[model samples]
Target: MNNRLLTAVFIAAALYLSGGFTHIAGAEDGVTFIPKESEIVSAATGKSISVKSTCPSGKRLIGGGGECTGYLNTLGSAALTINAPRPDEGAWLVECTNLNRNPGEIRAMAWAVCADAGVLEKNR
Candidate 1:
């Protein structure tokens, strides 16, 4: 009986050391996030202008945001707007407007994170 128990222990140790039946799980479809660079936005008459960044093929936008940069955002009346990425889409939209009723150009950047649909589903 002692010999049989020792043999069982040795077998279990070997299996563990050999990585048998481990079956480690990971992301489903290789989902990844990416950040987009800044883009240019020009608006007149306090009207809002939109800029967008799209992900590559076979990838979808997970989240995104934007901010307005320039003298107008600080000195002049300027505003920035960010919208969430739609389902299964790689489009991130941002709108910037000059709130001072003056014609000016402001620099804005839109950023987004993308991932594969299958991977996203696995996460959920």
Candidate 2:
């Protein structure tokens, strides 16, 4: 699979394991998958940019991912250097570098999946 697909699968698995799944009917499991997004940031050619998404009050981050856009080819694509939960467990951080030779701009953003901490305990 491609890097994007693999990353998505990994995030899904992490969310599932962390009790971030919501019910089909949206019933109260106290579990909520809150997707927090970072503002789009530009990375210059050969330069790296980092973005972060933080959970709201009373929510804890379970998993997260990121996207890099505006690239020429596989070799010139923006490569993600870091895509993981923050040490505080309340945010998600993502960093990517622009590999294009030209001084073009690339966009990168982070996504955070959050859930109620108490809900996680109840679900377990």
Candidate 3:
């Protein structure tokens, strides 16, 4: 059935897309991508992404990514800063807090979209 085929295709795409956490979403920065800001939240989470931000503040952007479990990503490499005077090849600044909690080797994947200026600019 067409519906079944579409479902299969979707699943395949998801697996292929999420296969690697490294290449997903723009740099770990906390900035938003000029073109695909929404991508940050699209397919960017998994059952393993137990850790997440609280009351996030930033521009209206989107991203896609996910987690595998046992991996803890830091903010300096996770948040995206979109307020830079000029953007790079879409590499936003990703500042994060360890929370001192990790899934333990399994590693979880995740992404964010926002205009974190202070943190990102200071570090960048």
Candidate 4:
């Protein structure tokens, strides 16, 4: 097991030194992975607001996360998620709802991680 680990590390080091993994997604080769983010805030209290954010051309969504913010110590929360349909498209959807039935506004944010479309092609 130890020998296998050592071998893997040595191979990675060699590849790095040889410039096999030096180019970024935006480089001339366009083989790097870049992260994309999107966010949406709710306007009305006690109501659910959904928002979607899209990625740029030539990019694909790989991962995502989200969060919600509302009144302090109040019955309010948010839900966020990622919507990825294809390698060329992705969206961040956020829903904020108030449970206290009060006049308050909540905010929801979603983050989407995107990568160069070329990266996907290379792997396949």
- Return the top candidate by lDDT: 2
Model 4, span 1-124: residue lDDT tens: 1225634754564344335775323334343233333233334545655444555566566444344555511352433322233434465454445545445556554454455655545533
Q: Write the per-residue lDDT of candidate 2 for residues 1-124, one digit (tens) a residue.
A: 3466957786677656655766321225443454434344455677777778887888777666776655422455777777788958588887777776655555556777666666556646
* TM-score, predicted candidate 2 vs. hidden true structure: 0.70
Residue 67 in candidate 2, Cα distance off native in Å: 1.4
For residues 1-124, what per-residue lDDT tens digits would candidate 3 score against the true structure? Answer: 1225634653454334334434332334444433211212212322122323222444432332323222333222222211222122222322222343332223322343334545333332
Candidate 1 residue-wise lDDT, 1-124, digit = tens: 1225634754564334334655322233354444454445556766776667777788766555566666567664667754446554567776667786667667766665556655445533
TM-scores for every candidate against the unseen true structure: 0.59, 0.70, 0.23, 0.49
Sort the predicted structures by lDDT, highest score first: 2, 1, 4, 3
Each prediction's total of clashing residue pairs, residues at least 3 apart in sequence or on different chains, is 0, 0, 42, 1
Candidates 2 and 4: which is better by TM-score? 2
CA lDDT of each prediction against the hidden true structure: 0.57, 0.63, 0.31, 0.45
- lDDT of the structure predicted as candidate 3: 0.31
Best by TM-score: 2
Predict model 2's lDDT versus the native: 0.63
> Over the full model, what C-alpha lDDT does candidate 4 score relative to the true structure?
0.45
Off by over 4 Å in 4: 1-45, 72-89, 120-124
**Could you give me the TM-score of model 4 versus the true structure?**
0.49
Q: Which candidate, 3 or 4, has the higher TM-score? A: 4
